[model samples]
Target chain A: MRLAQLSERSGVSAATIKYYLREGLLPPGRQVNATTAEYDEEHLRRLRLVRAMIQVGRIPVATVREVLGHVDDDSLGRTIRVGAALWALPQVPEPDEDDAYVRAAHREADALLDTLGWENARQLTTISPAYRRLVVALAAFRRLGYDWDAELLVTRARLMHQAAVADLDFLETQPSEEEKVEAAVASAVLVEPMLQALHRLAQEEESARRYGFE
Target chain B: MRLAQLSERSGVSAATIKYYLREGLLPPGRQVNATTAEYDEEHLRRLRLVRAMIQVGRIPVATVREVLGHVDDDSLGRTIRVGAALWALPQVPEPDEDDAYVRAAHREADALLDTLGWENARQLTTISPAYRRLVVALAAFRRLGYDWDAELLVTRARLMHQAAVADLDFLETQPSEEEKVEAAVASAVLVEPMLQALHRLAQEEESARRYGFE
Candidate 1:
């Protein structure tokens, strides 16, 4: 296929696709002539992945390059390839440990991770941003006078475990390696706001249910 | 309580608490002497709220003022007070209408809202930030070649509905109005990271289970 066909098929603009090529986000096509290059299904697949990372995931161009580097590195196992990309995404700045609440949270987080036997998951490469974020969030809750006991935290984790497995089940159905990786990345990034929106909407629905607004 | 006492009790420094007083994030304390002021439980409560907004929720000072203004207003009903703050939280920039994918997302979002009977929730004062986020995310997913059909979206919503209701039940257990409001805000803000972290951890666990890593 030609560039125009790829652009039309992908619903991305020609100039944008050209820019991606220049930026190495998308690989150059087979050179058929001086001004024209031929693209194949593989190029199309990669272009879609690039588009997902940039437009949907909102990953910085440089970060996308780094994440894609992880995706393309075959020396890593499949789980690490996916997990490493997730690990490489942006993270929150470390919270100040001067506060007692934050210090307590670290202890509580260690207990919770121990309860779940997730210590390996925490140190998979460096520490998972999720663990750091969890600790920060737990401390914040404690500071706000609403302590989330380990029982509550574990319950929430179990609920999310099912949702995550359900989502991964969907990704496993993708037909190609690139497609699976693209789907996993896109699902992880794109599904977040959807989940958040659902929570808010559900809250609204519940409020209405309780207050006769429905 | 004096400034020093307030600092000791809240774990917020006297200097920072004074800054909040000057910035109107906290109300003025009673001047008990030429060089000292007397704070009360109200001040302590407000201090916790302000700290939660800044430290845990990461709300900007100006936005916290706006949200707190809504919270302090007696004219608005409780639902709108909380709902309005949720509505006022930041939003994703509107997607490009020139792209067919985004246009399709707008249509799909509308259809999903209709399916859920949430049009009123979308326009509570103005379009809810969550609603706007949902649309942007939907467009992004469509661009990534994953159309979230209405059935799937509804299923996700039901799951979140249960979780939101459970959290609200905890909020209802608070014994005072201000504390209830503070806990509501903090839970809504702080719990998101916990939920997100849980999702990621769950994903890790599921991957381990499937691939024999656990």
Candidate 2:
């Protein structure tokens, strides 16, 4: 298919597609002649994935490019590939290390992970900023006199893990490593808003039940 | 306490606290004299809350001001106040209204809510943009041929609702409406990173278990 057909089929503007090509977010189509190129099914698939990453996942283009590089590279280990994809998603910035609260929060996080007996807890260091921020947030909640229970956090993690396992089961079935990587990354990044929306809805329900807020 | 003491106690820089004051995110301190003011514990508390909203919650200053306005206003209904706080939290941008996919996703969202028998589902329209974006993201997942089950979503929601209930239980005990609003908003915003971090950690655990990775 030509660029116009690809644009028509994918519902992406030709100019945006051209921009993606220029940014190397979408690989260039086969050169047919001067000022013309042919896009195949692969290009269409990639275009859709790119759209999902940008439009739904809200991943930055540079991060998407890096993530896609991992997706296309076969030599990288699966753990690193998956980690790269997860890292591409947005997260909270880490607090300054010198801050007393941040230091305490990191200790709290380590203790919580230890108490939960999560294997390879130190792998959290890879996403340390987000993890550290979580700890800081939890500590802030505690200072406000809220009980952010360690047990409760573990329970929530377990439930989310169950949901993820189902998603990963499907992901594991993709026909190729590349497809699997794409699907896994897409699932990790795009599914977040769904989870968040459901959480808000659930909060509404809980609020109604607790406060008679109908 | 003076501004310096408030800054020292809160661990926020005096300049930033002054900025918050200038921005009206923090209420002005009591005027003592020209170029002099006195802040009390209320000011200190508000300063901490403002910092939490900005640093940990990642809420924009404008939204923080708006949310704090809701917090300070005594005449606003509880539901509206809580809604404002929730609204102040970051959310995904809604998809285009005219897009067929987004329309379908909205329909899907409505149906899912109906199936769950959630009360006052129409209130979703107030925050429809974020909700619609979530539905659109879910639809994108389905388009990718992943079975993102409604039942699965509900289960996740139930689990999250449980976590929320635990948090809200603490919120319910606040002695004043202002305190309740502050706690509710802080929990709504700051807890998100904690949840996301735990989700990622859970993903790591699940990945390790399923794929036999370290």
Candidate 3:
């Protein structure tokens, strides 16, 4: 099939098909003429797999390209390699933002730093960037005279990060490499909503219990 | 003190502070003269609270304004009203670009829907948008002839959501409202990382057991 046909079948635009081909996100088709190319069933399949990595895994194009190179090959070694590569990728931090809040966060962080003992203080940067953002918010909260202490926050944060690691390990289990990939993809994509839902459920249940309403 | 002193003390830049004032994210101060206004410790504290809400809670200004109207008011009824309002605000979703891979995922999702006996497949629209995004990716995986089905995915998702609720209830066993709020805020800000960590840990343990390598 031509690019147009592939686009129609896959629900992707022809221009995007070309872009994917050019970006090496998709393989080149068999050249049928100077201006035309022929794609096959495999191309359609590959297209879907690509979507899975990007949309579900939330991977960037460059990283997806590397993973695709390994996954499309489907050799045991390559699959292992792809998994290793996925592991090597740094855990993503939170969303991007302007420096206004970021700067304020840094300063307030210094005050919290003042309150910590050496054992607790060790390396403040050990927290993930996402957590760093939270620390900043907490710093602001501190200014409000809430009287929440730094030690408790740090300890809770460390415990939470540990728990998250545990969850990831649990979610990734599957009998086969294919299953691992499937679970991994699902884990990555479903995680944020799971967190949100969990927060609501936990808060509601806690509130009910505390208020003696339920 | 004046704006400059408050700005220095808060570490939030004067310009951003001005913006916060204009946006009503910060409360108004006593007008000292035609060109000056005097803000006190309460103003300083409120600025930090606003930062925490925006930067930590990731709540928008409008929502924050409504929440604040009730949150810090001395009246008990108002605080209760604000808490209720906070729960009712609509979640604003993070945006992502549509791409070829997303198209593939949608197709896989459609097939999964068929298999799962989900009669109102269109009900996906009412689910969290994240779930819809995942369906798109999962659809792409199906196109690759993977053995995964919708049953496992849905089951796991439901379970995880349930577990999160359970965790919140567990936290509510704390003795005081202050403790509850502290735990809730910490959980809200830190739970995602904790969940991610937990997923990783569980998957690792399961893999070790399945492979008999531990």
Chain B TM-score per candidate, please.
0.87, 0.86, 0.45
lDDT of 1 by residue, A1-214 (tens): 9999999888889999999899887888999999999999887777877787777667899998887888777776667777778877777778687988778888887787778776555554135677777777887778766555567677667667768777778778788766676667767777888998778777766665665331
Better-scoring candidate (DockQ), 2 or 3: 2
Residue-level lDDT of model 3, residues A62-127, one tens digit each, is 876766564544454422433444443346454234655455555545554444332222232443
- Model 2 stretches astray by more than 4 angstroms: A27-40, A88-95, A123-152, B28-40, B88-95, B126-130, B136-152
lDDT of candidate 3 at residue B147, scale 0 to 100: 54
Model 1, position B203: C-alpha lDDT score? 80
Q: Please, what are the lDDT tens digits per residue for candidate 2 over residues A1-214? A: 9999998888889999999999998888899899899999888878878888887667789888887887887777665677666666665555667866567777777777777676654565545444665676766765543444566566666666666676677677778877777777776666667777777767666676666552
Q: Rank the candidates by DockQ, best first.
A: 1, 2, 3
- Fnat across every predicted model, in order: 0.57, 0.37, 0.11
C-alpha RMSD of each candidate structure in angstroms: 3.0, 3.6, 9.0
Q: Which stretches of candidate 1 lie over 4 Å from their true place?
A: A94-103, A114-126, A143-148, B94-103, B113-126, B148-150
Q: Which window of ten consecutive residues has the lowest lDDT sum in model 3 chain A?
A: A116-125
DockQ of each: 0.50, 0.38, 0.17
TM-score of candidate 3 to 2 decimals: 0.53
DockQ of candidate 1 (2 decimals): 0.50
Q: Which candidate leads in lDDT? A: 1
